[model samples]
Target: MATTNFDCIVVGSGNAGSCAALAAKDSGCSRVLILDKCPPDWVGGNGYFTAGAHRTVHGGLADLLPIVRNVSPGSDLASTIDMDPYTAEDFTGDIMRLGGGRSDPGLVKTLVENSRDAVQWLHDRVRTPFTFSFNRQAYLVDGRQKFWGGMVLSTDNGGKGVIDAHQKALNEAGVEIWFDTPAIEFILEEEAIVGVVARRDGQAVRLAAPAVVLASGGYESSREMRGKYLGPGWERAKVRGTPYNTGDGLALARSVGAKLTGDFAGCHSTCWDFDAAADTGDRLLSNQYTKSGYPLGLMVNSNGLRFVDEGEDFRNYTYAKFGREIMNQPGGCAWQVWDSKTTSWLRDEEYGDGVVRKVWANTLEELAETLAEDGLQDKAQFLDTIHTYNLAVDAFVQQHPTTKWDPAVKDDLSTHSLPLPKSNWALPITSPPFLAVKVTCGITFTFGGLAIDPDTAGVLSEETGKPITGLFCTGELVGGLFYGNYPGGSGLTAGAVFGIKAGREAAKLARRL
Candidate 1:
């Protein structure tokens, strides 16, 4: 075995790990090394395959002015012209509400309070480019687009943009990044993590460092771990990002007495195109794998039954967990059906040639037949479901007197009586050329991981109920921020926020030790 040494060792090369390494260097750590299991071809981990949206606290356009560039002075700039502002209080409230108050208090507060600062640092220090993502976060309102929810800004070119910026920053900082190197285990000295045994070039090597930051992400890519932690049938869920996030950080930390926390059986999942390859992470097709237009219309299983509330709230509130609902269906699959009235409102992912698996037809009967040909056994039930929903829409409109359904706000249009109901955006399928897209569960990242102190980003030991001396963690590896559900775009924010904290704190610790 070979041995190497560094002041700080950061595992993973995603947004979080890179941010950690950069911060460590900025904090005066002379030697910082980042170990990534992926080769140069697949370096960014899950962050490489994201839209790179970050939910952070901002006063309004004034605060976002520096972060987002190229804002044309017109309402036609997609949906960000009239975007709403979000304060730290708003972000904290969202975390609590979305996580059902189960999120760790300290961790949530750290995320919200430091989000604005972390985002600012990214723009100012890392020089990451950002812009408003109207298609994902905004809705059309009275011909002028409006951004709803707290998340509106994303990397200029999506996840690839973010990774590119981080890699550039790391290079300028002179941080050593070891691609294709995986941290196999931690070297614990008297219960404190001091170094790591890593596998580089197919050989076990020792890397000695006073402090180690683990941002290697979760167990979403491991079929065995998903089956064990996320429960049965999760093995069928499509991997949304890097196949290397196989709980390496979590497993290594837990081996050294770190406590496991967050929703072990839950994860950030979404409606994915069923035709997508099983484990390949295509940077070009990053955003195309998801099918989020289900709120605009209806989703039916093979039995032609609506199982969950399509319009429970906004897509951000429901989209993450809906993939599990699809997986729970009879065949672990569902189809999102939309009429001509709502089809135009869909994002481009649905219509892309190889992006999604879709079926088009002139009428509901034809749509049903097409779905049947695509493996839906109950064609009659499918047609009847559409007819029943349409009739309900007609009755609701006649009695409620809807003038014009505003796309920006949740409309009053709803079903009068149904076993499972659509709570908002209830548009009837009355127009020709209806569309249905086949979808399955797309698991993004596992929610359960190592428990850490929010203030210091230090991993906590379950046995002692105290922080481990030199082990710090961030990214998806740090648990307690999310439980059963999560607000979309908060993951990246949390990762950067804590990663920066971990790096800074670890650097300080290294200097002291």
Candidate 2:
């Protein structure tokens, strides 16, 4: 066996690990080696899958109040737990409440207090330009604007985008990078992490470092881990991101007594795919369900029945809802039905064109026939549901004079100013070539792994709940922060915040060592 030495060894080159490396270099730490199982091309992990929304309270809570009020309109900002002062006390309280009281309070406090500085450091020192999406423009949380600006993107021009920028900055600052090297296990002496055993080029290499950072993403790519931790149904769900996130880093950390949290926090929802072969390259490439003000649309199980409300936030309990009603159906999938009106609207809408290409159908019967061909469901049951839905639409429209026949009225995407003519606008599926497309539950990121102190960004002992000397963890590896509920783009915000802290702290420790 061969051995290598460095002041610090950071495993997993996603947002956290990359930022940590950059920070360590900036903190005057030399000889830092950042190892990742995947290359820079896929460095973002699930961050690449994100719409790039960020929630932060850089200013005091008072300044953020207006943003929050604007985001969740008609809702009392002060009544929301996140609206409290952005102090360490209030932030920790908010995390515990959002985590259903299961989160480590100490870690949550650190994350909240340090989050603003982290955002500022990334924007000012690291120069990672953040952007906002039009859809999330007004959304706010805890008095801070959710998204700072349009698509807060990195100025680095390349295939890797922000990930590449972080990596490049680390390299320029003298940090070494090892690609295709997977950290298989940790070297523990007297119950303290001292080094790691890694696999590189089909050989095991023991790398010794006083400090280790595990930023290796979650277990979404591993069917075995997903089944064991998430649930049995997740074994069948489509993994939408990097295939390299097999959770080896997480398993190794846990083996060394690191606590795990939020194992159940993962995005589960119906996503369009032209075929099983179409699973590659941007999972939402074929989504036909348009996002207006709401998830205005219809979802039919293989049996051709509306299973759940499309407006239901898929990030929350939508997957669990589908598991109970749609997963075990005829084809283990579902179909989305829309009409020409929706087709035209989607084309004209901002996020519509990309989703419209997913649907297929020439007529009501033809759409059902096409679904049958795709092996998604029984044509007869699907046709029957369409009939029932049509009758309901007609009756509802007749009862309401100013009504329009659109099945997606419930998810009315129309602006608030343009209220629907009727409360229920059920469009008839009588048009020729009715459109339908196959949809499967897709995962965004895996939310489980090594536990760390949210404040110090240090790896904690699972039993004693104290920091492990010379070891730090951040990003998806830091468990218990999110618990079960994800507050939209908080994943990126959390990673950036903790990554900067971990890097600075690790560098300081290495200097003393």
Candidate 3:
């Protein structure tokens, strides 16, 4: 404990914590320290497992070309692309709408307003490897690269690349990060946080800091917490990120009388590979375990029924909540079936050569039989569901011959006369060589967390209904931005936004102290 003091101490060394630490240093904090409960391998925490999809408001392709390394303006490739400008209204509306109007307006506004700036800051200041998410966002349709869904940016090499950039930036900033050190509690003096008590090398060490930022992720990793808060059967959902994000910071903050907010029973979940690890995410595979191709086809549960409107919206908007619907099925799992015409469109990262065990057959009957072996309990009903779905598509196309099937946008190529009609991009399953992939729910992060002041990112007090002096929070730890559902890519954007705010404010508080 030679220098047992710092201007600011950040708990958790994930994307949010790293962002806060960098912002603190850049904002004039001389000594900033980061503490993580995980070992060195989990350096970036859940950020290490992210797909690095960064959703931000931008002026379409022209605005993004400067920060991205994938494509350049005036190129032949650029001429073949179609990208629509995304405004703050689009971003704000998406979060509030998807979250069922439960997201805090102040927090959502703060997040949406600063989103583009945060992306630019990440590129310019952190030297993050930015690239157009062509593989995930855009698709080639008739020699045109059309971008859909409002998300267009991702780090090269996904989460690994994002974390690598943070590591380099942290090293340059000289921020000392202590791995395998878990913050057990905060030192509160006269009802204001003054320091942190953490277990370092199996010893209790007290580190002095006028401001402490809690960015230690959420309770998604703890099966107990999941079962307790997120309702029944969530404990069985596959963990899509770091195992260390077990609500440690939430507990630490609550121990000091922090107010909890957001929908405790809700979370960001998705269709994960059925065969994926149940307890933790695979570092090597990372977000590849996600099976989001359901938006391109149809999904049937164990009873062999189409449970959701696959084309309810862009995959980005609907994927998070669909996982919970899958869990609600009879067996708590489902199968995504696509035909030869659309199977090729599935991203290589998710359904390519060896991403997961895939079932293939030249006929629908054989496909159903194959899936039955893997968990399709009602093969006869599965065949009937496909038959009825194909009939509806044929009827719709016959009535509206002008409509074209385009995956890049919601072209309204829908099904007709069905109890649960697919809204758009609906095509007949007539192509041979069908494919089916089994999937289960993958929990990303718990939405429940500490209530924070939207302006300064300070943790709010439960008793006083005010900001706790010298105590701040960011990332998944500081919630109230999401509820029943979440907008894809907003997680990282929200984290960076509040992380920067927390850092700057905490640095000011630290200097004053």
Candidate 4:
């Protein structure tokens, strides 16, 4: 086998590994090798699928307080706001609450404190172009309305833009990038990561290094892994992002005594239609709510009954709702119902590359028939449910105003006021065609993986409960840091923060070694 050597070997050139490698080079590491399973064209990993939102305890998070105030001002705004004046402490609390008490509090603190500086470093030192707005929030870019205190992002050139900018900086910093090279396994000795075994050019090569960084991303693409770890129901969910994240690095790390945490991953639930399209190869595209300006309608299970509030954070509730449907409902598929007005609004917004336009039929019966033909739902049951729901909606609308249809407030609207099938029959079942779309839970990225120290970004030992020597992890692999829930814009922020910390700290260790 061919062999090589480096001061540091960073596996997977996505946001975390790329940032780590670049930071290592900047910190004076002489030889840093960054290995990616796919070529640069496919190097984005989950970062590409992101809306490029970055929330911080800095002015950005503070700015959102006003927006929250505008929406619901009467409550204990401070408690609901989840912000503290101490930027670091506030961020730590934010992460801890989101992590559901399983996160490494130390690591959470470190990430929160350094996130702002790390983001700024990427912007100023690396010259990556990012805009701040309400959609973009603090470090976020590409937000639409200014009503919210968010940020915006624009691509530097015609390239994939964000990843390209980071790649350019890495290249300028002289980080050695090996593409189409998958790290098959790690070479560990005496509990320290020594090097990596990779496949490059149809040949196996052993590359020796003092430290190894596993940034290969989470295991969303591996159906087998998901079945084993995320349960059987998850296997049916739609994978909306990179299909290349097969969890190779995690497996390799596990073989070397690394402990796993946060195996329950979360995804953006808005891509529900894509989840149903998994077998058909029809990808679900996002930018729906933001791009289309239409409110997400109610979601019903196989029995044609509404479950949770439609406005719940799409990321947190999508998979949970899916699990509930599979366990409680028949056929294991959910139906999304909307009227002509909502359909027209969404169609004009260009949902899912205009597939929503084609999905919507003229009448409720026709909509059910089309769905049955598409193999998305059962025809007879779906039709019956639609008729029943229409009657309920009509009756409810007659008793209440438009605002009464809101799912956020319950007592404010009577049960009769809720828009059921009876509410308004303007575009009733009598209408030649109605609109229905089959939706399944779609995953964005797996949240759980290896645990790491928040302060140093070092992989923590499961047995000893301490940072592992010469091993660092970042991005999705660092579990417990995010807990069960995610704060908006924290994915990229966490990756950048921990990657920088890991790189700099690893460089310091290398110098001492």
Query: Best TM-score goes to which candidate?
Result: 3
Tens-digit per-residue lDDT, 326-352, candidate 1: 999988999999888888888885456
Query: Distance from true position, residue 122, model 3, in Å?
Result: 0.5
TM-score of each: 0.97, 0.75, 0.98, 0.76
List where candidate 1 sits over 4 angstroms from the true fold. Answer: 72-80
CA shift of 103, model 1, Å: 0.8
Evaluated against the true structure, the overall lDDT of model 2 is 0.59
Q: Rank the candidates by lDDT, best first.
A: 3, 1, 4, 2
Runs of candidate 2 with Cα error greater than 4 angstroms are 1-3, 39-41, 58-113, 135-160, 264-294, 313-330, 344-357, 360-362, 384-434
Per-model C-alpha lDDT, please? 0.86, 0.59, 0.90, 0.60
Clash count, predicted structure 3: 0
- For residue 148, model 4's alpha carbon misses the true position, in angstroms, by 5.4
TM-score winner between candidates 3 and 4: 3
Q: Candidate 3's residue-wise lDDT over 327-391, tens digit each?
A: 89987899999998898899999998789888889999998888777778999999999999999
Candidate RMSDs in order? 1.7, 7.6, 1.2, 7.1
> Sorted by TM-score, highest first, which candidate order results?
3, 1, 4, 2
Tens digit of per-residue lDDT, candidate 2, span 1-513:
777878788887777787887887788678888888876556656555544444555443344333321234334643432322334454455456545787666666666766667766766665554533323332343454343211222222211345655766776788888888888888887766778888898999999877888777777677788788776676776665567777777778767777665546443333534244322335343112312221334668867676655444322223323432344454557776766655443333223444434556676776776666666556788777667666655665565556433321132322211122212333555665455556656654665667777667887777887888878888777776766544444566788888887888877877887
